[model samples]
Target chain A: MCAQKRAKSDVGEGSPARADLDRTRAVLEGPEIGRALTRIAHEVLERTKGGEGVTLLGIPTRGVPLARRLAERIERVEDRSVPWGSLDITMYRDDLRLAPARALGRTDIPAEGIDDRVVVLVDDVLFSGRTVRAALDALNDLGRPRAVQLATLVDRGHRQLPIRADYVGKNLPTSLRESVTVLLDEFDSRDAVLVGPAKARPAPEEEH
Target chain B: MRHLLSAGDLSRDEAILVLDTAKELAQVSGRSVKKYPTLRGRTVVNLFYEDSTRTRTSFELAAKRLSADVINFSAKGSSVSKGESLKDTALTLQAMGADGVVIRHSASGAAHRLAGWVDGAVLNAGDGTHEHPTQALLDVFTMRERLGHLEGLRVAIVGDILHSRVARSNVLLLHTLGAEVTLVAPPTLLPVSVHTWPCAVSYELDEVLPKSDVVMMLRVQAERMKDAFFPTAREYSRRYGLDRERFARMQRDAIVMHPGPMVRGMEISAEVADSPRSTVTEQVTNGLSVRMAVLYLLLGGSESGIGNQEGQA
Candidate 1:
């Protein structure tokens, strides 16, 4: 995992990294994401013995689609629906000012209401672990879960917080100056994970 | 320091404490960071089902000032308008792991239902005409900032008390803060069981203006406004509006306040709202401070239970 420049701010909005989101979208839909999420679903089912009372929670934006796909795959294999909900974890980030301001998304839980259920947190990629830590804090405000597990489509690990995805689809290692971008078909036309230079750059004056 | 669901929830002492804290927070609003990080990483969601630019935006800014990550959720053009139930929407917030939910809804008791639905702290930003706790809190904060004390003070809240959540919240909260509140509205515009409230009733704003230490004008909500509440807007303004003549009746020290999005010449003339004695603009400024005080004390600073925790230090 990339560990260089830990203080690097997010490449957001007008940042060039945002422009390259299209490239990441192509990678997501192109057989690779389909293969990865399917593998993760299979592993989750094998570990949980067909996900009895397990709730699949997707962190907002990217995580939501991944969670939906995992739930569909789990249902097809098990012949029963696994409860699914979407979470907006924007509030939980430790470094809020590091990224551009964003509107909060929807976090929708199933009717069963989280109590006594095994919750599996879904995210696109596992980077600094700060997102998951924030998710933990956010989960506390929800009802008590019997147990909570973490799942990630990409484990490009650079652990800032003491967090680890319980279920991992694939692990890729890279330098700190690199970035991992995940795109899905629902919001993006293609599915892909791209390894690229950090999109954040200095002002135009420092271009030389 | 708990969720401010209603102004009535705060006792006189609690109200004073919040105002005092707000004064201190106002001093640092222009700093480079312009943030305290007091609620660092704490999630505050603006789950608004009703359309509101002023209230929603103000609450969002308030949360941001305290260093809370604010998520603005507008129901318009979303799945919510497409028949997605409130339960579904609330579950979404729960899954997102929101820390605090500040909600505004057209339907009364929407906040109550949301409280039962989410495990997070629920604050009623504005729940129909049932109550608007923060608005009332800010109004009180404005009053305390200008008047110094609330006890034995005469506060006249004029206009559509029947359809105003702000009026309902203010009346209850002001009385709790030891102020004598008089509700001046047309008899037809008063609530059916208005006498159950802590404040006295008056059909005439002019008759009550002389005795008032504070004059608070409530907006005549244009959308839900039913006719015959008064003959016409002009007549209502003539009777209840704080125009120059009405303003002259108020004590020289009496401050005027409005929750805002004011209809310049309708409820109050522009001159009265812009007057030196008016606390209308100050109400907006005080809103952030009061909200900051609420978020900090509820989520942090548990060390100060009440009354002089500083002396021990």
Candidate 2:
């Protein structure tokens, strides 16, 4: 009976999907993901003069793979390695208590650090711009980069903050009722971007 | 959901999540910058009702390392020593807008009672002999770090189980994580409710030592001993103390562990305590990361930053 109680709590009473998002359409596919990352890699190299002092800090989960893929492409083009690491903005986020608690993701800044370097922050989807704000806050604590730029696979517009991506792969406008989902091989074992209408969020229980 | 009052309060998944989060955050310490902006703009008050330099300092460091504002409140001075009640003290902290409270109290279940008075997260640093949830989390974190896993591991806890909130928390947590536990101590030192705990009891330390993967030596609380739990400290050392010879008899890869503030000769010898297999110091270092994980989870702001990357619409 105690084990049963533990089992229930193990998964957590907190709902993972607070809002039920219904799948509508698949926007980007596996091959398209590969092509988009390659293109972003070239754009990153061109903007910063052949990847000199360039560092790619993925915003974890999908962003990590996107960063790595870009690094590989940049390395091939520039004939030099690009310093890469992961920056987890879980703690820096603004909407922490507004949603169910999320587990912390990996924050690995390279040993040499992001100081005096052109650091490119990579993420899968760009939405409310709050995540980018949190990422900026997280980067400030690490070390001041020479210049910090944002890159994303999709920029589904309705940004709450005045933040905008530096190198956006696709500028797909999204509605308030829809959610953008980015599935990466590193996490979901597949590469695809899907847009869908959000199902009604369960009404939170009323306090007595 | 808002408080960590006991080890049993964490489900298997929550426990693992804390450990996993600690594992990720542990990398932060390795970096030259050794800081994360996770808890910035947050206030964490270490309201220690008991005298504890290590636990309080560890929590303070954890909060600061995460870039959170920390206030170290000790019961030694201030209104607490002026006969002010715990409720009033808590209310004062609440009024100050404490985002989280890391409390250590002399009374059992003080953390639980404090949870009722505060809207912020309450963490039981060590509440009498009831539970030290973070300590247990760190112990298991150290165990998992050394053993690479906790499943099916043999852990023999020695010395003062009766007065140990660490032992109580460890037994519950380790059992939940599928580790077999055996409490090796004098029958007198064992609690009256020991039989109900999810662990085995053994008076023969030598017999249990050979089969154990982790031998945890708890501090013999001389202050708490009203009656003679054993004949003498010398006799207790000869029979149960982890001397070099006794340590040699265990599995070669077997590690020695203590929860700190260890009595050098009474429960564990200096040789065994300082040996390569000992994780006493690692337990302290791991304590910082484990406490950071707890504070992050409870006051970590949003639960939306984990596993699944996609947030709500």
Q: Best-fitting candidate, measured by DockQ?
A: 2
Model 1 chain B poorest 10 in a row by lDDT: B304-313
lDDT value, residue B238 of candidate 1: 86
TM-score of each: 0.58, 0.88
Q: All candidates' lDDT scores?
A: 0.74, 0.81
Name model 1 segments beyond 4 Å from true: A1-208, B301-313
| Top-TM-score candidate index | 2
- Show pairs that collide, candidate 2: A96-B301, A96-B302, A100-B303, A101-B303, A102-B303, A102-B304
Q: Compose the digit string of candidate 2's lDDT tens values, residues B1-313.
A: 3778889877788889889888877877766578876677889999988889889999999999988999999988789889999999999998999988889998998988888887677888998888898899999999999989999999999999999999999999999899999999988989899999999999999999999999999998887778878887899999989998999899999999999899998889999999999999999999999988888877775442222111111
TM-score for the A-chain in each candidate structure: 0.82, 0.84
